[model samples]
Every structure is written in C-alpha cells, then in structure tokens.
Target: MNWIILVIAGLFEVAFTSCLGKAKTTTGNEAYWWYAAFALTCGTSMFLLIKSTETLPLGTAYAVWTGIGAVGTVLMGIFFFHDPATFWRMFFIATLIMSIVGLKLVSAH
Candidate 1:
C-alpha cells in the first residue's frame, strides 16, 4: 500500500539523517563512508516518497513524511547523541505527532 511505503520512506529519512549526524562526529575514512551511506539512504528515501506520491495527495504525503522524520530525528538526538530533552522540546514533539495523526485521519485515502 502507498501508506505503508510512505511510512517506510519516512523511516529511511530518519536513517539518513541519523547517519548524517554520525558522519559529522567521525573523521577521515569513517566519515567518508558514513557520508556515502547517508547519500544512499537519502536517495532511497526520496525514491519511496516519489512512489508514494503516485497514490497519495502530495501535500499530505510530504507533511506526514517530514513530520515523521522530524520526530524520529529529535528522539534519536536525545537518546543516542545525548542532546537536550527539555520539557518544552518534548511537548512540541508530542504536538507535532498529534498533528501528523490528525492529518492522516482527515486525509482521504
């Protein structure tokens, strides 16, 4: 299903962005490989997004995809990268998630 593919694509977006963060923290050959992985992962993510767009509304698809990516990235930063996880930050993330859900519920499949 297109929705399934879209969700996978969003997960890929998270993967690539996390790879980017890891790449920045490395050096030399390791960094180069991480960068390469990031590029490949991002490319795959975009390809899936394009495929999903064939059946889903463009605006809804893009917003949900980006929302998933944003939430995943923030969580990864807090859990893996030891980034700050303030109350306001968590609150906004929850709000973003709710919005994403609301969008999905309102969208005509």
Candidate 2:
C-alpha cells in the first residue's frame, strides 16, 4: 500500500540521516563509504516517496513522510548517538507525534 511505502521511505530517511552523522565523524575511506551509503539510502527513500505520491495527496504524503522521518531520526539520535533527552525535547517530539497521527486520521486514505 502507499501508506506502507511511505513509512518505509521515512525509515530510509532516518537511516540515511544516521549515516550522514556517522560520515561526519570519519576520515578517508570510511568517510567515503558512509557518504556513499547516505547517497544510496537517500535515493531509495526519495524513490519510495515519489511512488507514494502517485496515490496520496502531495502535501499529505510529504508531511507524513517527513514527520515520520523526523521523529525516527530524533529517536535514533537519542538512543544510538546518546544525544541528550531533555524534557522539552521529548515533549516536543511527543507533540510532533500527535500531530502526525492527527494528520493521518484526517487524511482520506
């Protein structure tokens, strides 16, 4: 389904973002590899997003996709990168999540 594809694309967005972060910390060959991975993953994510847009409204699809990616990337940062999980950060993340759910519910699937 388009929704499933969108979700997968969002997940790939998270993966590519994480890879980008990792790339920033490396040197030479390792950095190049990470950059390549980032490029590939980003391409795949975009392709899936384009596919989903064929069925979903452009605005709805884009917002939902980016919303999912943003949430997932933040969580990945907190968990894998050991980034700070301040109360306000978590609160806003929850708020974003609620908004995402609201959008999904209101969207004519």
Model 1 per-residue lDDT tens digits across residues 1-109: 9999999999999999999999999999999999999999999999999999998999999999999999999999999999999999999999999999998899899
Which candidate gets the maximum lDDT versus the true structure? Answer: 1
In candidate 1, stretches whose alpha carbon ends up further than 4 angstroms from where it belongs are: none
What is the TM-score of candidate 2?
0.96
lDDT of 2 by residue, 1-109 (tens): 9989998999999999999999999999999999999999999999999999999899988998899999999999999999999999999999999988998899898
TM-score of 1: 0.98
CA lDDT of every candidate:
0.96, 0.94
Summed backbone clashes in each candidate are 0, 0
TM-score of each: 0.98, 0.96
- Estimate candidate 1's alpha-carbon lDDT, on a 0 to 1 scale: 0.96
Query: Candidate 2: lDDT over CA atoms?
Result: 0.94
